[model samples]
Each structure stands twice: as structure tokens, then as C-alpha cells.
Target chain A: MNLKFKHKEVRVFAPASVANVSCGFDVMGFAMGTPGDEIVVRRSDKNTVTIKSITGDEGVLPHDARKNTASVAVQKFLEHVGFESGVEIEVHKQMPLGSGLGSSAASSAGAVLAINRLLGEPFSRKELLPFAAEGERVACGTAHYDNVGPSLLGGFVFIRSTEPLDIFGLPFPESLHGVVVHPHIEIKTEDTRKILRNDIQLGQAVKQWGNVGGLVAGLINKDIDLISRSMEDVVIEPIRSVLIPGYDSVKESALAEGAIGAGIAGSGPSIFALTPGEESARRVCRAMKSRLDDIGLPSDEYISQINTKGAQVIDVKD
Target chain B: MNLKFKHKEVRVFAPASVANVSCGFDVMGFAMGTPGDEIVVRRSDKNTVTIKSITGDEGVLPHDARKNTASVAVQKFLEHVGFESGVEIEVHKQMPLGSGLGSSAASSAGAVLAINRLLGEPFSRKELLPFAAEGERVACGTAHYDNVGPSLLGGFVFIRSTEPLDIFGLPFPESLHGVVVHPHIEIKTEDTRKILRNDIQLGQAVKQWGNVGGLVAGLINKDIDLISRSMEDVVIEPIRSVLIPGYDSVKESALAEGAIGAGIAGSGPSIFALTPGEESARRVCRAMKSRLDDIGLPSDEYISQINTKGAQVIDVKD
Candidate 1:
């Protein structure tokens, strides 16, 4: 019997994500366009995981199959579905780490989505989340789904359960716009985790839940007034904001420029602004970049709509 | 010319509530039927707050208008809305205090609803919530809206935010049955507050959020499987459950008897069990009660459906 295969190679686009979207702390996340990573995966006859190419990195990322985010994610997916096949994965790390652009998550999500399609889509998007998170472990020393879920699924995501595995892709409120400022600085997830307190006050915890609940309700009901009122961090943002230069000034300036709310982007040296419209988003970007520039730092900014499409097989080449 | 003036008295009923439902901690709360407080407000010429009668308090409650739960709430409402005339409030406190039944909240809610009607409905239900919470402060010393919102609005309530006042009443899943076994012991809110540690581990906090998210999604989607799976508490229930007699044993017995979940009610002394049907709710209630009895603490129990109606004006005289 002769079997002919078509559309054998897949090119995946995974959007950059903003993890810990202010009020949600560890559970809320969303994806953005412009600054994301791309992964290209192909069916191969190799006996082991192989990374065929590397691009967009400053020659710092590893080419080893086990070390690459896409390759490890594919390996994890193979183990997940009990599949015994080898494939070649390529990484294009467009978004820089420590820029708070979800660099590792984008690559991890893109590779998994690409390879899963190549493998005939045996696993659902949610089933592939843990694999993406596992790949994230290689980059951050911890498996966090905040960025990975949004990167893979796109839009606004609420990670409802991690064990026994449940996640919710909530509806993105229409007319939502954002500005993300990436200051050229380096801060590893490990160092960021270390600086956070191991314990938090019960009072602060109550406030955190209040904000999370408000944020969820705001998104669900499309109540922009409530969303702006709820985007607050009395717990971690106050502590983590110090890591980024001009963080407070940038946030204040962003809000002053018609942005409704501003917060640290993930565990960052980067920050994000939520605005009501495209005009406000553009103004926020200008304000955030100017704040960073005033502090003698080179900053890259993206004014974007909330990316509703997570990870997808944009093209296929046999 | 002869001018005749007539006065019409208004009465309102507010059901007793249960807050911090199992794993929800500060976000989830719901109201109950049958054993709730009733307030009858009569329009009077004098500018004074007065509590005329009280029942079900075993003569232990205060008679002074300032000290009465319903009276104080009416006073706050009148002052806030600038009502110049006096109103006579009669409080029938049917639910017992310190039973985790939200006894004080019911009276507060009943008064606010009754007064709103007596004054020709000057404010929205959401506007009256803080007034109810203010009355709750007379009993609990703090303005935690968990109980007040549910008592005022009914159904399954999620207090999304309290700052700019965001409260959402989520749809109660069909076939949801609840069982309550009150141990007849007093567990004050202050005691519950005092026992909890000021600082909690970040890991535990994350788990708490996961459970909350799961519960919210379950409510939104009406997924019983998700609801049962999400009924867990690593924070408040664990520490406070120690204060309730046979708490662990009762919970185990209830779950074993087809209960979806069971936990210490409010802070302690009362235990609640959730089931999918009336039969299962009855069986779980019996099983939980028997378990408590075996531990030498027999309790009063109720098996009912989730209360969908909140506070409303009533005609007690009729």
C-alpha cells in the first residue's frame, strides 16, 4: 500500500502574552500581536527530537533539541499521547526574554500547536496546555500557565484549574485596546520569583480576590467602569514595580494619557496600559515610551488590540 | 377646606444568608428560605428610629433602636437618603446568630428594603447594600459584603468589587440542593477573624484562587462536575473547621451520601452539605446530623433549594 501525504509542514504563529494581568495576579492572562514568536515544525524520519534551525536570537538560545522550547514541548506532547515518533522543530525567537513580552511562552505555544497539527491533531488545545507549561519550566524553572494559556489559546484567558486541568477562555470585551512598553533590560523569572514574598497578609489576600472577582465580572459583563475600578494590586505589583525603571512614572503617565489602568507586565522590567480606544492606546504608547526614554532607556512599544486568535497553523508547506 | 392624611406601612422580608461558601472564602455567598428575618416599617409623624418588637432571640437581643439590627439599618437609610420623617421598625429575628446563618444580615437587609419602599423607593438595591453592610457591622464589627449582598439581592451572589460597588448575582444551577446542620453552638465572626493567620503561603493562595475560578466557571456554565471538583479549601475552612465538632467526620459522611461538597458553615458551629437532588440532600443531611450526633453534638438541620428571591416589602398586618 502506498500512502501519500500533503500539507506535511506547518508554520505556527503564537502571539505574545501578558501574564498576571494586574488584578488576576497569577490566573488572568491575554495575548497581543506585533511582538510574538514563530515556530515551524516538519514531519521527519529522525529517531530523536531535532532542532533544524534557529533565527532572531542573538546567538544566545540553545539549538539542542532538549533545550529548545518548541522541541521540549513536542517531546512532552509525545509523552502525553503515548506517541513514539520523531519530528524536527525550528524556533524563531522574535520576542526577547525579560522584555515581558512572553518570549518563552510564545515559542512553547507555537511549537506545540504546530507539531500537534503535524501529528493529525490528536490532542485538544486545552490538553496541549500542560505540555506548553512544561516547556515553560525549561525557561523559568517553574511551569506557569498564565502566559502559556493565552499564547496558545489567544484572547482573555482565566486558568480555572491547573490540576485535574481546567481552563476558561473568557470573552474579550469589545473596544479594548492596550499599550505594552518593553524597556531593554534583563530580569529572569527566577530572580523575579525570589523577590516576591513567600507569604501575604490575609487582608491583602481578601483584596486580591475582590479584584479578581471584579475583573472577571467586568470582562464578562462588558462593564468598562468596573474594569477600570478593579485593576489594582495591593499585594505584588507594589513590590515588583520597583524592578523596572520609571515604572511608577510610566504607569502614572499612561493613566494620565487616557489609559484607564496600568500595571507591571508579568514579573517585569516591562509594563502594560489598558485604554478604552485606539486613540487612547496610541496616546498611552507615546506616554509609556517617553517615560522610559526620560530614564535613559531604549524602549520598544506596541499598541495593539487583544489578540482573539491564540495559536494557529497559518501556513503549510509540504 | 378639609385635608385628610393617610399613612401606609411597608414590610419587607430578607432571607438569612451563608457567605464564603466552602472554598469561596470571600467571594461566594447565597441566601436561604424559611428561616429568615422580617421587618415591618410603619410611617410615623415623629422623627425617630424605633424598634417596636422582636422574636426568636430568646429575649437576649437589645430593644433600643440604636442597638437593634433592623432599626440601625433603617436609621442609616433614612439619614443617607435624607428622609425627615420617623419610621417604626419591627424585627422578627427568626434565624439564630452565630450559627453561620447570617442572622444579622437578614435583619439589616430587611430593614433597608422595607425603608426603601416606605420612602417610595429612593435608591437601587445596589445602593442599599452598604447600608445593610453598615447594619451588619453592628454584629460583625467590619463591613464585609459577602453576607449583605446575598441577603439583599438573593440567588447565588459573587461580590465582584466593593470599592466602586460591583456586585453580580450569578445564575443558580438547576437541581442544586443544600443541607444545613447547625450544632447549636456559638461561633462569632470576631472569633473566626481572630483565628485566621495574618499571613498565608503564596502556594496556598494560588490554590485558593484556582478553586474560586473553578467555582465561578461552574456557576456560569452550570457544570456540576466542575462545581464538585472545585469544592476545596486550603485557607479558611481548614483552620476554622478545627473549631467545629465532628466537622471532618460530618463532611466525609455527607460526601459519601451523594453530597457534591460539605464544609464548616461560615466560620464554625454550623456545617453545610451540597447535593444534586432533594433525596440526596435529605440523605446527606441525615448522614451529617448522625455523624455529629455520634460525636455528642446533635444539630438542627434544613434541606432546601437555593433561594432565588431576595428582600422585598411585605404587609404583615394583612
Candidate 2:
């Protein structure tokens, strides 16, 4: 039986995203320029989905389409389009696993793009979101689109609701640069999700809601100072940050260095800071990364503007 | 000694405002046309603040300048401007007392604007928000800028923070009309505040935050459908609506009649609904008013375009 494609093939790129963006935990995210993932898909002769190869994930990810995130995403896409033909997938993880940079989501976003392209482009980029979000249900215990939504749609993505699957892109502030610091430590997403309390105080909820609204207002108005003031996460940060070492010190360091706002990225281990320009972002990255270093934890830092283009077809083959 | 002003005076019109706006409790507010308060500020001879007269409030409001919301606002303005001269204030409450229409905030907002204009505009309109918020502290148990901010700055105002106060006006959607239904029964703001639970479930809080962020996005983008979908109030509405008569039925009726969203106006007897155009707004008003009518409760219904110009000077004395 032939396992490879007859002729149709496609490759797609998907960017890593920063979920929560400090104040909007589980509801907002934005894409980054580098350290993304890529996937290659080919329509095959065999009537079963196959995972050909996965790089940079340390061979830890499952090969079965049902058990893997990107492959599951491909399965959802095929099921959605009613395409019963077999598809082979190749995932290249440009980012490290457990880095709090939406590594799993990037793989899923990339695979959907490749599969969708291979299927004669049956869906628009926006239409590919649910299929990618379905991948999240397999990667994490629960399904969410805060990561995949931004990773697929680009810019600042606001997940208004996941139950009804309402998501949209927001305006990225001009001159805004993201300074992300990934500490050389591993923290499972499930563990972070488990740490949050089932109940929250009303006062704390009010503060968090205020910040979320303020952050959205800040972005749309291009008010950087307002962004700095509103990037506070009163609910999830206090609980989840406890699991990450040097969380408080790193955030304080970034704030002290004139960074607009600083908080833990995604679930944990990685912290990010936002600044208006390249210089301040570099300055903030240095301050935050050095603070982590003080705690005996080495870190990897990346600086880039908000990625306006989300998942893209870098190459397509017929 | 003449209690009234000797020569200089200024009167400002402060529009009635809907605070909380269903989802944004204590953090969001928007102004409405007509049925507002009028405050007249005049230069006095003595170095003391006094309330010259109070109308439409049944003369129940405090006469002492330090205790009265309008006079307290005037005192704060004078202190902020470093002015030693005394001021006399006259408040005409066009809206009913305890009508859930931000009556106290309207009075406070008007006094500050009149006082500022009388002082040759020592501060801008945005700068006077804090002074007006300070007045809310005298009226309500705690200080909040949701009502004062919109009443002073106009349009859709977001109260980011009260400390070192940061507030900005969001773009008001065009062709958006406000449909307000105010029942004759009065519910004190303090009573409503007391009935609220100090704690809220994390799930509920997350829903509320998502809605607030969505609402901000909808208003900025002028997405009316998104606004309708995002106006769900999970925390405050359920709890606070219990205090109002026929709250649930009224909301259901409004939704059935094509109202975008509806909830308790501020803290109770008054409930407001939002719609895209004047026709739907009027239809929603009839539906809500008819519901109240069935409940054996008389209600005053107001239909108007979302007031863009907040407080204005119908007459500016030089």
C-alpha cells in the first residue's frame, strides 16, 4: 500500500501565541513573529491518517492521529470537510515544549492550514479556527481557543466566547513590541489549570473585569500608558504565578525598567513584558531575563512586533 | 447677608447616566438625554461653602456643603484649584431621587463643571472626573467613577481605576439608541449594595470578564450583533436583579421584542435596554413598559439616542 501522497501536498506556518496577555486570561491572545511551528500535509493512498515526523518535541508527542494534537486537528479538518482520504502529516516544532508559548496550539494551527490547503482550500483562515481548537481538547484536558484563535487569525485576538465560538481580531497597538522570556524550566499546563480556585472573591473579580475592559480600551485607543495600567491580572495570576519560580521578582523587574506591563505568559514558567518600541522591549527583556538568572534559572528571550499575519501558506504543491 | 451669589455664576447641565450597564458593575457608564440634574455654582462673599437651595429632591438632601454631594464636589474643585473663595450651589434634581439614574453623580458632575467654568476653566473636563467621583463618596458608601466619568466626559466612558484616576472615553456606536424603563418604586443604592455577596464563583467571574471585554470591542467596532451577544451579566445581574420587581420578566420581554440587552439600570427600580435603532428602542420600551403595566407597577419610559455630549453649558456666564 502506498503511504505517501499521489501528488497533492502543502506546507503551512503557524506562529506561537501568548495567551491571556496578562489581564485577559482564557479570553485574549496575540501572535509573535518567531519561534513558531510548521506542518506539511499530503493526500495519501492509505485510508488512515499517519504522522510521518515531529521535530523539536523530543519525540514525546504521540504519532497516532487520534492521540496527537496536530494530527487530531487534521482529523477534525477531514471530518469537517467530509474528506475520507488518508493524510500524512509532518510537524516541525520551532518552539520548545512547555515553554508557555502555545507550542501545542502552533502545531495544531499549522496542521490545519496544511490539511486545508491539501484539500483544495475548502475553508477560509477564520473557518479553520474550530478545527484547530478541537486540537486543544486533545492537547489539554479541556478545549479553549485563546491560543489557537490568535495563532490562526493573527493580531490581537479576543475570544469573546468559546461555547458559541465567537472570536475576532483586535487592533495591535502601533510601535508595540513583545518581550517574552522563557525560563529554562518545565511546567505542565494541566498543573497550572488545576491550581486555580473554583471560587473567587467578588472584589477580585471586579478588579479583573476592570482590567480586561481597560486593556481592550487601551489597545483600541493606542494608549500605551493605559495598557501599562490595565495589564493587571488579579484572579489567575496570583494563584498560577505561585507555581512559577521568580514570578514576582521578574514582573517587578520589568515594571521597574519602564516596561508597560509584565506578567506570566500562558500557564507558567515563561514571563512576558510589553514595551512601546524595540529599545524599551530589549531593555525590558534584559531586565526580566536577568532577574530570572538571579534565581538560578537561565532563560531564552525573544523580541518581535505583534504578528499581523497569523497562519500562512509558505508553500503549496499540486 | 445675602446667601446667593453677588455677581458671578455658572450653570451646567449634567445628563442622567446608566451605571453598571448590565455587565460592567461599578466600572462602566453611558449618558442619556433629558430628565437630568441642573447645578448652579456662584461666587460667594464668605470663605465657606453652602447650598443656597435644593429643588426636585423634596429638600431632603443635606444642606451642609461638606455633606451634600453637589457642594462637596464644589469644595473639591476649589481645593484642587487652590481657590480660597466660598461658593454657593443650587441643585435642581430633574430626575427623581433614588431613580437608579445616577442622580447624585449628575448633581456632582454639574457642580464641578459649573464651578470650573466659573473659575475661568482652571481644569479640563477630563480633569474634573476625580472631583465628581469624590462627590460620589459623599453620596454612596464608596467612591466610584463609572457614573461620574460618563456624566462628565460623555459618550461611553470606561472607569479604569479610581486611584490616581485613569479614565478614557470609548467611541460610541452610531445609530445606537437607549431604551430605559424606570418604575415608580424607589430602591436606595445603599440597600442594593448591602444585598450583594462578597464572593463570586470563578466560572461566573470569567463569564463576566469575557462579556465586558466583548462589549468594549463591540462598541469600538460598532458591531451591534456582537454587542447583543456580549451583554450577558453573570455575577451582578442575577444577584442585583432579584431586588427589582419583575426584573426577569421585563428582561425576557425586552429580548423577545428585539432589544439588544437589558438589566437593572444602576442599583434597582430602573431597568435600561439597548437597541440598534430608534424604532427597536421604541418597540423595546413599549414591551418593557407593558410588562411593568401587567405587574401593577407604573413606569416612566424614555427613548433617546445614546447621548454623545455629556454635560454641556446651556449658559456660560463670563
Candidate 3:
């Protein structure tokens, strides 16, 4: 059988994403611009996937094709498309692993995008989301789309349901900027999930959903003040903040520096603050870093507007 | 102190609202065009508020100024504006009381608007919400704003927080129409409130909030399909539907007749269906009525476009 390939090699860039998003926990996220993963895929003669190389993961990420998120995601895509030829994958980690920045999602998203392009784009970016989520299942226990959805679909994404996989992108203001500060500490997603209560008060749930509606309205209308007011987490933050040192102080610093709102990103030790503009985002990032500095902890800060384009093909070679 | 009156008498029409719009629960509602209360306020020589008469309530509503929602709301408004003159209020109840169509809210909202205009428009309609809420407090045990907010605000209103009185209007499609079916039996708001579980599973809460977010997004974007998908209530509907006979069948009938979505209108007995336009709304209303008819139950049906102009001055006398 003749292999139909648009490009012999393809390189793709997939963005990091911030999930949970305060009151929108387990449902909302947005892609970021700076910290991302780059993956390269080249056609192989043998019908077997291979993880040829991995970079910048501090020697921790798996090298086996079945174990690595990038390779696993690629394999899923290949199987879905019934591709007979195998692909050699190279994983480049641009963001901190387990930093609440969707590190695994970026790798998985990038890998799928790269392989799809090499195979002449069999699937649209959105169709690749499930394959990317499979990577998240391999990395974690749940196949949650909060991280991978945004990382693949771009902009602000809302996951309405996970079972039937209903997700959509939300409109945000052009002036909106995001600041994410990741403290050099790891809080496993599983541990954070364990800390949350199995049940919540009906009143609290009402308040949380109220904020969720308000937040979505605020984003749609581009009402900065309303957005700031609605960015509150009544359920999860209080329970999970205990895992992050100086969480309160860091959030206060971001707000004090004119951030629209601030909250724990994903599962934390990463804190995210939204600002009206890039300058304010930078100021908020500095303030958040200073708070962590006061506690004698190092942190990595990223500033970006919402990534409107998710995964992009950077290079293609015949 | 002299009472400065712009007009000797003022009559206002305040809309009946559907609260707890499916997934929105306690935070969302919208005004209806028909079956609203018409309140007439005439300047009285005496300095104390009085209820002159109430029509269509079958003598069930109170005549005492302190107990009557209309008079109490006007009293609150008069006190807030420091008006010395008393006003005689006439409550014209156009909608069924205790039908979960926010009948009390209509009375309170209409009274406040009428009295405000009689007192030379001392407060904006938005400013009249608290006074109307006080009326709800008088009727029900707790002061909730979901009903009064939209009845005064004239649109789809979202209450972010009740304590600080944070509320905002959400944009929806111009073609949106509402169908409300009030089954003859009354399910008291307090009884419906009692039946709800104090604690709900966290997963259900997440799903509810996700739907809330999706609903808001759908409204803003005018995505009819998303609106239908998001009009699901996983928490309150399951518990409260038992109180209303043939609840599922009635909702199914509405949906089957091309309604976008349908659910219990508040702490129902009243079921509301939303559709793309007036024709579909009428069809859905008929379908819902037929379902109730199937069970040998009588029901009152209302068809309305959203009341964009919430309360209006219908008459004035000098």
C-alpha cells in the first residue's frame, strides 16, 4: 500500500493552558502564549511508534512510546485514522511539568497536531481533542478536557459536559491579559482532588453557579469590573489552598497590584491573575512573584494574552 | 413637611418573572410581557400607607398595610426617599398567586414603581429592587432577588450576590419567546424550598455550574442549540418534580413541540418553556397544557416575548 503523506516531517507548537479558572472549576480554561510544548514528527518505514528523543523534562518524562503522553496521543490518532506507517516523535517540554500549566496537555496536543499534519491533516484541531485527552488519561487518572480542550481549541473554552464531550470557545475582550506565576513546588493533581469535599452545601453551590453565570456573561460582554467580581471560587479554593504556602498572600498581592482577579491555577502551586492589559499583567506578575519571594520561594512567571490560535504547524518538510 | 408630587396618582405595570431558569437555580430570571400586576398609587392626605383594595386575589392577600406586599414595598420606598405623604395602593393581580410565576414580586415591583413615579420618580427602577425584595421578604421568609430583579430591570437579569445587591442584565436573542404553564395546584415556595437536599454531591454541583456557564454563553451568543442543551437542572428539578404530578411528561411535551428548553419555572407548579419565536412559544404552551389535560388537570397558559421594558407607567393623574 502506498502511504499518502503531505509532509515527511512536521513540527507543531501547542500552547499551555490555565484550567479551573476560579468559579469555573472543572469546566473552563484558556490557552496561553509563552510557555508551550513543541513536538516534531517524521514518518518511519516500520509500522511501530517510537519515542526517538525527549528534551527539557529534567530526565523525568518516559521514553517508552506507550508510557509517554506525546507518543501515546500520536498512537491514538494514528489508530483512529488507520495509518499503516509509524511515526518517530520528539517531545520538547517548554513549560514546567506538573506546574498547573497543562504540561502534559501541551505535549499531547503538539504531538497529535504534528502527526496529523504529516498525514495530510486527517482531523481538524477540534477532532484531535479526544486523542489529546487520552494523553491526559495516561498522565493522570481522569480524561479531563479542561486543560487539553483549550490547549487544542484555543481562546477561552468552556466544557459544558465531559461524558458526551460538549465544549465551546468563549469570547473575551481584546485587552484582557493573563499572568500565571508557578512557584517551584509541585502539588500533584491527585492530591488536590483528594482534598476537595465529596459534597458541598446547596447554598454554596448556588453561589458558585451564580458566579459562573456572571463570569461567562462578563467575558461575553467584556465587562472588566463584572469579570473581576465574578472570579471567585467558593468550593474548591478554600479546600485546596492549604497545599500551597502563602497562597492568600500571593493572591492579595496580585489584586493589590491592580489585577482584575486572581486565583489558584488548575491545582496550584501555580497562581493566575487576570488583568485588563499587558502592562497590568506584568505588574501583577511582579507583585505575585514578590509575595513568593517574601516567603523565600522561587517562581516562574508567564505573561500572555489569550492564545486565539491553539496548536500551529511551525515547520513542514517533504 | 410638604409632599412634592409630580402627579396626583400614578399607575404602573410590573411584569411577572420566571425565576430559577433551569440550571440558573437561584441566580437567574427574566421578565414576561403578560399577566403582570397593575398597581395604582393615589396621594392620600393621611401620612400612613394604606391598601385601598386588592382585586383577583379572592380575598387571600392581606388588606393590612404592614402585611400587604404592595403597601410594604411602597412604604419602604417612601421611607428610603423620606417622603412624608402616604399613598393608597390598589393591587390588581393579573397572574395566579402561589403559582411560582413571581406573583408577589409583580405586586411589590409594580407598587414601588407606581409610588416612585407618584413621588416624582425619586428612585430609578434599578434602585427600586431592594424595596421590592423587602416585599418578597414579607411574603416569603427570605428576601431573594431573582424574581424582583428581572421584574424591575426589564430583561434577563443575573444576581451575582444578594447581600451586596450585585445584579446585571444579560443579552439574549430578540426572537426569544417564553411559554408558562401554571397547573391549578399550588406548590408553596416554602414547601419546595424544604424538599431540596441541604447538601448536594460535588459532581452534580460541577455539572450544574457548567450548564449555568453554558446557558449564559448561549444567551450572549444567541446559540439556540446550546441554550437547549444547557437548560438542564440536575439538582433542584429531580427533588422538586415529585411535588408536581406529570412533570416529566409536561416538559417532554414542550420539548417535543419545538421548544428550545423547558423546566420548572421557579419552585413550580408552573412549567416554563423557551422557544425561538412567538409561534413556537404558542405551540409549546399548547403542548404543555395538553399534557396537564391528559392527567385531567386544569392549567393556565401564558405566551409572551421577554418584557424588555420591565415596569412602565401606564397612567398618571394630576
The best candidate by DockQ is 3
Per-model DockQ? 0.58, 0.78, 0.90
**Comparison by lDDT, 1 against 2, better one:** 2
lDDT of 3 by residue, B86-199 (tens): 889999998899998899999998898888788777667888899999999999988899999889888899998887778988889999998999999977888999889999
Which has the greatest TM-score?
3
Model 1 steric clash pairs? A154-A310, B11-B314
- Candidate 3, clashing residue pairs? none
Error of 2 at A101 (Å): 0.7
Better of 1 and 2 by DockQ: 2
Colliding residue pairs in candidate 2 = none
Task: Report the TM-score of candidate 3, chain A only.
Answer: 0.98
lDDT of 3 by residue, A124-173 (tens): 88888899999888998888999999899889999999988889988889
Error of 3 at B219 (Å): 0.9
Q: Number of clashes in model 3?
A: 0
* TM-score of structure candidate 2: 0.95
Which should have the higher DockQ, number 1 or number 3?
3
